[model samples]
Each structure stands twice: as structure tokens, then as C-alpha cells.
Target chain A: MTMKYKDNPQAVADLVRPAEVHRDLYIDDEVFALEMKHLFASTWVYVGHESQVPNAGDYFATDVAAQPILLARHTDGEVYVLHNRCPHKGTKIVIDRTGNTGKFFRCPYHAWSFRTNGKLLAIPLKKGYKDTGFEQSEAGQSGLPPVGAVKNYRGFIFVRMNQEGISFEEFFGGSLSSLDNMVDRSPVGKLEVAGPPLRYMHNCNWKMLVDNQTDTCHPMVAHESSAGTAVEIWESIEKDENTKTPMAMEVIAPFMSPYEFFEDMGIRTWPNGHGHTGVHHSIHSDYSAIPGYLEMMVEAYGEERAKAILGENRHNTVYFPNIMIKGPIQQLRVFIPLAANKTLVESYIFRLVDAPDMLLERTAMYNRLINAPTSIVGHDDLEMYERAQEGLHSQELEWVNVQRLYDADEDLDEEAVENGTTERQMRNQFHAWKKFVVASMEAEARDLTDA
Target chain B: MTLPTRDDLIDFVYHEARVIDEGRFDEWLELWGSDSYYWMPLDYQQDNPKNMTSLMYEDAFLRKLRVERLNGLRTFSQKPKSRCSHVLNRPSIEAFDPKAGQFITRTAVHYVETRLDDQFLLAATVHHHFEMVEDELKIKLKRVDLLNCDAAFGNIQLFI
Candidate 1:
């Protein structure tokens, strides 16, 4: 049986055709609201990492689907996710972004308290509600409403508001390799976020930022000026004396790779909207020159396993809807959607535990030179996102094209591989988006009828 | 046991800021010691740079690379060049150890920068630690603690 939407399903269907998406899908307030409801509310969203709150009473405040949510570790060492609103009078629990809430959470508004797991602890005036219909059961005061499902896989926590959907394992699928490869770099399979994340706001739709992650066509053009500067610097130094390309130039020059080199690197996608392309070792393959790191890896996990771990060089893996993992460089960039035209990007660098100090130093260098606000390379990407957003506002342009090789066989799961320059990743994302929206609207319509 | 006076330290800081503001990259480069470090830490009370990250942590080599880009004609972001005006509060000498030959000073700085019709303000408490090589004080470590260092920012291409 085919489910039907109460509202204009034709409009939603037409929003994402086979080869193009309507411009309004990005800037329309109605579409944004529907996405927040159907796509965000129903899917699994990434919360804070478990290492962020390792000790009991440690809490990290973040949002899932624009809804303020709290992630905390209790005395039992189990992590839990809860809505940020207080049960009484509906005030926020933790005012600051993150900190260790000693013992339990004490609300600033009415002095109501809750445990680290959001269990109602004590209220200041207990006798006032003796017979006022405020029952004294475990859920009487209604401490806080927790998300329907919370799963922590290898210390990376993901939460889903709706209970029914694909399991976390199934939703992540082959994309889990991205996370596994990152964690497995550590001999003990653990990695810690090195420092505080570098946060910045981009004036564009969130999807545009995500699309650019695997959109190989734009880098050569968008980064032309900065890449030219790097090349000029390298050439000037070489002209003066005998020297190799500067490490900084090596980092920026790859963004200028010819279309042929980029396309030769395969673009592959999995079930759901996950996709990744480009080589793993990238510019940092030279990092193999560092001493004792390979020996240490060989000692920990034998030569075969170590070689496999070091040899798997995949770049820019998108876990769909929000996160992008550059596993080779040990950096995770998360996109948080603020509005139809605004997004927040947080860059988190990781440290491979028990690894050499040079690895962490290189990771830090990459973040400063690439992800920082002062980044010469990053400004190019930012300019492109903003310009694309502004250009979409023109009344003449109705559709944003994703038709590059749209008819290719890359859409099939068994043969889901294409040249890096193809738009199959973007098209796959829309297919997933359409599926999510259609299911969401039908469920909403059924609820309206039931109500 | 002689030490540099407060006026001398203030003048040094003022001159440093002036050169950076004027885009006199060569003159600015001369103000640092051969083994100097310029750092802007990521965390408020960061412990060690080896384990943690920093926003701007540059050695002499990286610093020279940055200056090369800033001074280059091909730096697209710097083509129009950001102009800055720094308002520094009074400097106070914190410590003067004769044996160590290091003088420490601290000051508050409010910097206003403009580029292509966009302007932004950055405030930081600046710390300078140095020792006299002969008669001139060369900076060994210059640490800047931005008031909103952890917050979001636009491109920080120019010196602050």
C-alpha cells in the first residue's frame, strides 16, 4: 500500500527530481521547518563525544536537531542524553555550554534538582505540593524527558528522538569504517580530542556545506588564487637555492590538482547518504618519514595489520546529515544548522593515544593552517559557500543542477563507484532526503487523523 | 643590577604595534629573538602545547612563512590588505630577575581592524617576556590571551 501525504505531496516530490533540486529547497522557510520536523527529528543525530564527559557528573551541552540536549555521565559511568529544559516551570538546566555539574543538576530557576542521569532528586519546597496533584513517584515531578534512543559506539554517542527507525549499526553501515580506521590508529583503539574545537559560522544553507565535502569539481576553481600563492612562494624559494616544496605549500597545492588526477581517485557511496573520495595519505604521506612511529605500530599490532591500517588512505568521509570525518588527518568537522541561511562548523582535532608526538603536532598544524579562521586555504571555501547562497537568491535561477553523470551506473549499490568528479553523491543524498521526508509527512498526517 | 624602565617597555610595545599595523613586515621581524615563540592558545588555561592545540602557534620558520605570504603580491586575501589600529593600555613591569636577565610586562590591548568595508574588534591581554641581548630587548615569548579567543571569528590575517 502506498502512503499519501495530507498536504501537497507533489510539491515535496517535485522539490527533488532525479537530476536537479529546486532552489527553494534551500531557502524556503516552509521546507526548512519540514526538514527540522521530518528529517532532523526522526533521524539519528550526533551528540557530544563520550570522552568529553569521562568522569561522573561531567556534562556537555549541545543540540540535536536544533533542540537543546544535554549529554552527561552518571556515577555508574553510563552516559545519558536528555532535553535541556527543566521539568518545573520549563527553564534550562545547564546555563553554560559545558562543565562538571557536581553531584547533581540544580536548576537556577526554581531550585529543583536532578541527578546526572536526569532523575528527579529534590525540590526546594517539598510540602507545598502535598495535595496539589504533584505525585511523589519516580516520574511525578517529571525530572526531564530523555531522547527515545541513545547509543554509544566506541565512545561516539548518537541519539535519535524517535524510537522507531533503522538501528544505529544499520544506519551507519560501511561508513563505520571511517570511525574504526580513526580509532584503530591507536594501539588500544582509543583516540582523544586533542584540544578545544575551532568554531565558526558560515552564511549558507547547511546542505551546501555538506555537499562541498565530496564535491570535487569546485576545489580547483574555488581555491585557484590561494593555490597560486602557495605555488609562487615555493617557486621563489626554489629559485633562490636548492629546496623541496614547503610542507605548507604541499598542503595547499593538492587543492589545485588537475581534474584527471582527482577523477582517477574513486568516488564511492554506501547505503544511506554516506560517501567519500580522494586519497587518505594526501599531503601527509610524507609523515612516514617520522621515526619509531611505524616500529611502534608494528610492535603493537603486527606488521601485516599495521601496514593495512597505515595503508588505508580514504579522504573526506561524510556520515550524512551532519558529520564529515577526515580520518587520515584525524580531524572531524561537524555542521550544525542554525537556520535556512546559516550554519555553524566545528573543527575537532584528535590525538592518537600512545602515538608519537610528531603526529599530534602535524594534526595541530593542519588545523591551524586549514581550519582556523586565519586559514588562507579555508577563506576560499567560505567565500564560495557565501557566494553560492547569495546567488541562489536570484529570481531567475529555479534549479540547482546535480546532473553531472546523473545517468551513470554509480547509483546501484553493487556498482556504487564513479569518478571523483561525478555528482552521484549529491544525487544519492537527495534520494535519502526524499525518502526521509515522505515517511515523515505520512506519519505526521496519520497522527493528525488520529488526534 | 640595572633593568629597563616602564617607559622603555611601553615604547618597545608601541613601536612593535606600530610596525605591525603599518605592514612593515621586515621591521616587525627584527623585533623577535632568534628563538622566539608567538602563541595564541586554544584553551583558557592551557597546560602544554605539545599535547594540546593552539590557534596561532608559530616558530621562527612558520612565522617567516606567514610573513612571506602576507608580504607577497599573490596573497589574494591580502590583496586589499587589512588595516589595523591598536589601542594599548599602560604597561606594568611584573618581574625583573637580575640573574635570569628576563623582564616581564603585561598590557591590555583593544584592536580594531578594517578590510573591504568589514570591520571587527578584538580585545586581548598581551604578555611580553624577554631579555636584553646587549642594549636592546628582544622578545623571547609573546603570548596573547584574546577575551573571546574561543569564540567564532572571521579571518585573522593581519597581526593583532
Candidate 2:
């Protein structure tokens, strides 16, 4: 199958601009397919944390732009990201999302075997192929195609399907501090996955989830009903001397914050569509200190540095297309694109190693209350995303406006630090989106012409 | 042992369901002891609430918050209001503690909830650990093992 649009980079590039993006970017089938090939397949997508697959033979399976991939810890203590397909007949070796494949991966279809690092070990009935010319091919030698590049930064693993882009550190730019702050929270500078993730699917484009990460404008409007209920209930309790404010109300009441609060909170946009808001402090600041944890931190890093580390409270850090990390709350949401209109979100909670149990408990509580599939606050966000996808199907709405703060800070450098309520982050993402798509399209066109 | 008769236990379970089905949240609150726990584990055989995940875990304070939100007119998901019916199997007493006036009863329940023409059926094994204080049986712990606890769920605005 041939697509003429692949040759015309300008057609894809014109879909995105500094101030607005065409609805086709989210709704069109061709655009989604291009994004999967160019944007997702060509960039450094987060696979899993090294802590998730701690021991030898432990494997975590996931998709990189619809390409089934697995991250397995080999016996040599190195984690390798490999294609999940058995090279012999293209059968998926790892069916489960995550498990220990033991010493090596044994394909259920045939008796083909491979090492934990995806090196082909043996094929069934070697005598039959002995006389044949099938001595050693790429399929017989290498069981599966290992990911192009696998890098583990402070236990966070990122894999690139194609080795066309820059290094992960170069890709992360200034946004690396967000991850630094997350791991540096612990005195030992290590973190662990709390447990199995809370997995759910939404009927919306994957970009919608990414856009919502730095969007400070939606909470007040989208969650008006639920937040208002919490406020009303809280006031009634305050009026009565018998009752007290419920701790759970803290989760919902923050959604009722006036626009001015978010406006002043500030947003920071880095290179490569990486951006975050609520960088100064958040509602987590209001909670009482985790008992004795501060002393442990101060002892390790001294008072000034410990204070700085603990005070860096970021709401959500968008790592381009697939990952968002909430440093203070100790949670990460990974978006997996299933199609143009469907995305599967897997949310993982992290625990700071050697930290007080109270801290982990608080984070776990926040995950349940805020990110759980049955969460009231999360339901409001899901409703808006689904509605946006459904509403954009109309031909009347061609352009989705991302014009806030466009005139205020047209300068690229100055735009990095803007008001939190500004849609600068969204615009910045589309800027990277255009760059990635156009580059990939041009590369494919070059290959075709050369052929 | 001062255990409630099988007939008494059946009546108690039915009346509890009636309170929830009829949207009598205030009356439902009265059915629990002051130091009671309402929890639904996120994973099968999930024992520790503090260490692991739970679909729902509420002490009296959080439970009160949920009730207040459901009754508040501004609760949008509950705007059209949720109607539910609970089909409970015959109660089986698991244990009886004479000294502490406590009894553990187990039952299988099929809970159907409808709101704004959208309906969901949740099947679960319920364990009600109650104590007989004087003649009143108050729930000390209501643990629900949902058949699909780990599955993706929409807004669960009201009590399960």
C-alpha cells in the first residue's frame, strides 16, 4: 500500500502550527498511522522501570507504537528490550503483560528457544534443517530484534524502536530534573514500583491524554460538580461543632481552585514537547510532614539541599508522547495508543526506598483517590477526553485553538516559563509533533526515491 | 453463644440491602459501628490495605464524605440518581465469639445499579463481621470481594 501524503511532508506539517492544530491530527486515520510510524516508533518511548524487572529472567511486556516489545533482565544483570515475536514463525513469545520467563523464553507454538537477552538458542528438529541450506540466517541466529537503543536512567528504562533520534538525555533536555527530583526524594536516590499498576482504557486519541497533563484550565470547569459537592459538604461540617473536615475531601476540593491560582503557579516547557505545570508547590504542601522522614533526608543531604529537593513540587511532567510523571505524588501514567480513538492507560505508583512508611501510604492513598479506575476526580477528566474525541468528528470544527499566551510570549525561550494556565505547553507539543512527522515522512520519501 | 438465629441474620442482611436500594444513606450510616471498616480489595487475596492497592477503603470519616457527596445536589454523576437492587444469597454464619459478642457471616451478592439509563451489575462475595452490642447488630467490617475488582470501572459514585 502506498500513501501519497508520505511524499508530501508539507501536508502533514501544515496540520500543526504554533497557535492551532487541525482536527485531522486527532481524528483522521492517515494522521494516526503516520504518528505511530514517525512520532512513536522513532522516539525514545518509556518501556518500564528497572525496578519492575529486578531479578534474572523477569520480563515486562508492553507495546512500542503497536509493536509488541518486552523488557527482560538477563542472567548477566543487564536488562534488554527486545521484540516479543519469536523469529521463526513470528509468534509472540511473551503472552502475559509481565512475568519471569525463567532461564530463557520458550515459545509455546514450537520448541524454538532463546536466551533471556533474545539470542536464539535452538530450533526444534535440527536434523531436518541440517541437510537443507538453512544453515544460519538472521532469523536462526537472532531470535528477536532487540530494540535499537535501551538506556536506563536512574532505574527508568527508555527504548527507541529506531536509532534515528538523539540520546535520551539530549531528548529529555531540562526536563530531566523532574525525574531527578523523583528519585532524589529518597535518601538513597532509589525508588520501587509499589505494586501492579491500575490499568484502564479510554475512547480518545493518545494526544488528548498528553494535552491534559499540563492543562490547568480544565479541572475547574470539568470537575465543577464533584468539587462543588466536596466544598458544600466540607462547609456544612465546619458549621457543625460535632463533625470535622473529612480527609478524603482534600482530594476533590482542589479541583475547585479558581483560575487565578493556576495562572500564577507557572508552567515550564522544555525542548522536545516536554513540559510541566505547578512547579512551585501544590496541595501536597498542605499535608502534614511525613513523620521522621525529614530528619533522614537532612542527615543524608544536609538541610539546604534536602529542603530544595523536598520543595520541588511538580504536578505533572509530560515526557512527550507516552509518559507523564507526577513527582511529588509519586505516580506515573503511561499512555499506550491502540488506535486513532482508543488508548490504554497504565498507571503505576512508586515508593521511595528507605523512606517512612507513611509517605508510601499517603502516595498509595492518593493513587486510589485520584488515579483509580473508579475515581470520581478521574471520571470527570475521562468524560471530557471522550467528549472531545467525539465532538471533533464534526466537519464544522477544523482547527483546535492553542492560542493562549501566543502573543504574550512569541519568543521561544521566554515561552518556556509562562503562566500555568497558558496553552503554551500544548502549542509546544504540536511544534515537536510537526518536526517529528515531517522528518519521518521525508525519510520514507527518500528511501522510496532511492529504491 | 449469644449468636443471632438464622432467621434474624437473614432479616438483618435484607434490611441492610433495603436501606441502600431505597437511597436511605443516612439510615445506612446508622447500621455501622463507629470503628468500622468498609473495604473492597483491588486484587484477589489482597490482605494488607496499607501496603497494597484497594478498589475502595473507607473508615467512618471517608464513608461520611462519600455519603455527603452522593446526597449533595451538585454530585453530577448522581444528578439523575442511582437506583439499585441487591440480590443476596442465604446468610451462613462463619464464626461466633461469645465473649466479644461478635459474629462473622458470609453471603454471595449480586448488586445491580442503574443511573441515567446506564446500568452496571457487580457480583461479589460479602463478608459482614458484626458485633451484638445489647440487642443491636452493628457492622464492624464490611469487606466485599468483587468478582471484577481489578477490571476497569466507570464512575462509582454511590456505595457498592
Candidate 3:
């Protein structure tokens, strides 16, 4: 069924208030379709991390904005994001989650093959379609259709449906510096996706996950069980100093702190719906333990530059429509919108290239503690999102509130500061959403662009 | 060195499964020695437990914390209780070292878990490294290599 929008664009604009959004945005299927076309399709959506397909013939398959895409590293050392469908019969190739294709991808159905880069190689019968007007040499029809536009920012890849507009740096705005801060922390200045990600489908809107990334307000309320459990573990270990490792300290320390601590650390909201929150105290408690890392940074960039690299501790940075960069843990979670109610979250844990084993282990422990299936912290979040989904089904309420610190003034500089408890981040997200959606609608009306 | 007797190892495994299925966590913890390690490696190349991360790398302290939380009345995930069943088959004693008094038993494990209305099954190769201590069988290492170890997952609170 088609959704009927208000005839006036200004009336449609009024649906999103600074402190609240209409509940229809979450439950209406028509609005979801429009969001996929305008918000997801037009904006640069995170595809996958470069470390995922490091070697030739390595391919990672996933869906973005409800479109099936396969990110593959070709034999030529270039990563390509191609449509998963085979051109001949339109069957999906490479059914497995991840595997090395050796040299090329051969469709199991017809045995039609293509290079690891997705260039068509051979067909089953050469003479079958000789007179059928099928042109095999034309790369347009036979080869796998590549994503509209692909760009990589510091090994993190993003794809956009529209070829023109702002560059990825411009699209990311202030969030781009967060990526730089992440990579710079590693002495070698590079990071790779360590292992396969844990894939799960959540029965909630994708926005819930995005919001929760920088939503410091919910940690104390939602994750009380996890925080309590962490404290209990810390107390048990305190009796025996021998068992209290640095890695365990990293995992337990964050959870044991009071909610007021995180609020006092402050938050910074950037344009384009990107923001970060955390106490910028220290990246690592024991930076001196990794002498080799410290030496490399000091040698290449000097001690002052090294200090700046280690000083940034912005916990989680949200990249607008889909991705959340967790700098402390070196983890990234990308949300792929499946439906209004269901979202597929693909998480990747990264290892800092050439860093100390202990450092990597610490980062991995953080990932396991927070993102793992058995995480005490995540259970509360999953429950909350599920409840939010069910609560939105009510016919009585037409709007959802984001009223915390709603009237507070916001900083518009590159490093913008806002009250950590404020709904400023949510407002920023909606402002960006309106800009993209309305711009697309206006562009469509003017040029009659076909998508 | 030769593999352990298939029947004897299968009996041991089935008993262990029963303890977990019946929610006898304290009894389940008794199967391990003081130095026992319960490790679930995150990736294929994870070589050293001290350096690389594992899904569940617990010593006695961490194990105690897990048990305490599981037995805690406040564990919200466990409020309704998660029901689980283990179906063991295709037991293969991959390797054994009698001189070292250790044996490696590999078996295919199909575990299904249900909470409220959610149900999912996991198929994996479970490797149990057992050692003879004081003439009694004790688990040195319990490693589960899941079929989709790298896939995104929801909360995995209990041991598999």
C-alpha cells in the first residue's frame, strides 16, 4: 500500500521537532521505503572494513539498504563491492558467509565463472547464445554490477547510490577526525579486522542501535545488571591481586564507574548526525609497557605528536546513517537496514597492526565484554530496543520524546560541546535526516532524476 | 599415543551434558581441575591464549564470576531461565598422549537453546583435553569451534 504524504513540503517538515519525532516514522512502512531511497541510498553508507578482505580472492558478503552486496579483494589488490546476483540466471553466487575464492568465483548453478574482481570470465556453452543477441564482451550487461560509488576512508569503506555530491570527508564532516584519531593511536598507524564478525538480527529499528552508541544516558539505567556484575567481579579479583590482569582491568573499570562520571566526561556532537562521548583522559593506562610502540611514534612523529595520539579517548563515534566507530575497543558495528522493524548488525573487531600482543588482547577483551553474545552489558540494551519496538505499536502516542537538555545552547565549532544528557545528538541526527530527505525530494522534482 | 576409548569418552561427555542440562552448574564446575581452562578461540590463527583473545577464556576467578552471575537471582537474562539440550554424536578421539597423561577427544556437538519463544541450534566440534589427576578424570581444556564462530550473534550467556 502506498502512503499518502501531506501535499505541502513544509507540513511534512513539521513532523520532526527539535525534541521529538513523530511515531509514524518508526511504524509506517511507506516512510521506511522513502528512507531507504533518500537517506540510505543517497548518503554514504559504510560497506565493510578493508581488513575484512585483505588477501586476494577474499570476499565478505552482506546487504546494505536491503540490497545484497559482496565486498571482495581481487587478485590485483583492489577491493570491489559487487552485486551478489549472477547475470545469467540471477542466482546468488558465493552462498557461504566467507571463503577464499582462489582465483575466481564460479557460480554453482550454471558453472558460469567470473574473476575475483567480478569480471565475467567464461560461460558454460560458447555457442548457445550466439544468435540470441547476447553480447558477452560488453562489461555492462554480463559482469557483476558494482555499487554506484565506493570510497575508502582510512580502510573503512563506504558506498553511495548517488555518484555525485560531497566527498566522503565532507560527508563525514567532523566524524572524519575520529577515524584519524583511531588509526593514529596505533604505533604503525594501521588497523585490520582481526577475525570474523558476530552477525545478529535484532527485532528493532536500526536507529535504536545508532542512538544507543552515543546515548550515555541509558548506560546506568539499562545496563545496571552488567555494571553490577562487573563490580562484583572486580571485588572478587581485588582480594587476589595475582588474577587482576590489565586486560581484565580495562573491561571492568568502565562498567564499575558511576553514570555521573560519563556525563561529566562530556559529549561532542558534530554536523551530519555524527557525535562522540567519553572522558578524554587516557587511551591506555599502561602506554609505557609497549616501549616499541612508543619508540615508533616518537621516532616518526616525535614525542609531542605521540602524546596527542594517545590523548584522544572519545568512546564511540557514530557515522550518521549506519556505522559506529568504537575507538577504545577498535571495533566497528555497521547497521544494514532490512526492514523498518528488523536490522542486521555486522560487527568487526580490529587489531592494531604491529602493536603489542597485550594491547591487541586488551582490545579483543573489550570487544568480547561489550559486543560478544555473552556480554552482560548488551543484554539490557537488547531488551530495551525490543521494548521500544513494542511500545511504538501503541495507537495512543503520536510522538517519541527526546527532551533531555532540549533547550541548552550547542557549540557549532569543529569540536562542538553539549550537555552529555541532552537530546542534542538525536536532534542533530534528525536535522541531517531532514536535509538529505528534503534535498533528494527537491532534486527529484527539479531534474526528474531516475534512480 | 593413542586416542581414548570411544565408549568411555562418550559416557563422560554425556554425563557432563546432563549436568549442564539439569542446571547443575556447581557440579559442572567440578569436572574441571584447578588449572583447567575453558577457551573458545575467536579466530583460526589464535595461537597463544595469553596474547590472543578467546570468546570465553576463563580461569578460576572468571569462572567463579560466571557461576555467581548464573546463580544470581538478579540475572535478567536468566529470570525465565534458558532451556538447552545437547545432542552428541560422531565422537572421534583425535589425539592422546598417555606418557604426558593427557588425551584429546574431539566430538561433533549439536546444541539447541530456547528462551521464551526464541530457539536456535549450534553445530560445532567440541574438543576436550582431559588429564588424569590423582587417578580421576579432569578437563584441562574445553574448546568449542562453532560452525559460525565469526557470525554476528545475540548474547551468549551460557556455555555451549
TM-score of each: 0.91, 0.93, 0.87
Estimate, for each residue in B1-160, the C-alpha lDDT of model 2 and write its tens digit.
Answer: 3467656766787889889988899899888886898888887778877665677777876677667667665555555677888899987888776666668889899999886657889999998888776677788898999898767666565665
What is the fraction of true interface contacts found in candidate 2? 0.37
Q: By lDDT, highest first, what's the ranking? A: 2, 1, 3
**TM-score quality measure for candidate 3:** 0.87
lDDT of 1 by residue, A204-228 (tens): 8889988888888776776666665
Residue pairs in collision within model 3: A198-B151, A198-B152, A199-B151, A199-B152, A373-B155, A373-B156, A374-B156
In model 2, what are the clashing residue pairs, if there are any?
A: none
Candidate 1 error regions (>4 Å) = A1-7, A136-141, A225-227, A238-250, A279-281, A408-415, B1-8, B64-81, B95-101, B131-138
Best candidate, DockQ-wise? 2
- After aligning candidate 2 to the native by TM-score, how far in Å is the CA of A45 from where it should be? 0.9
Error in Å for residue B4 of model 3: 12
Candidate 2, A1-451: lDDT as tens digits: 5564556899889898779999888877778888989998777899999998999999999899888999999999999999999888889998877899899999999979999988888887888777566756766567777988998999999987886676887778788899999999999999999877777778788999999888888887777756766676667654556654445665567778898878878899987888888866555556667679999999999999999999988888999878999888678899989899988888888889999987777777777777776666676677678779989988876999999878743654332687878888888789888877788789888889999
State the C-alpha lDDT per candidate.
Answer: 0.78, 0.81, 0.74
Highest-TM-score candidate: 2
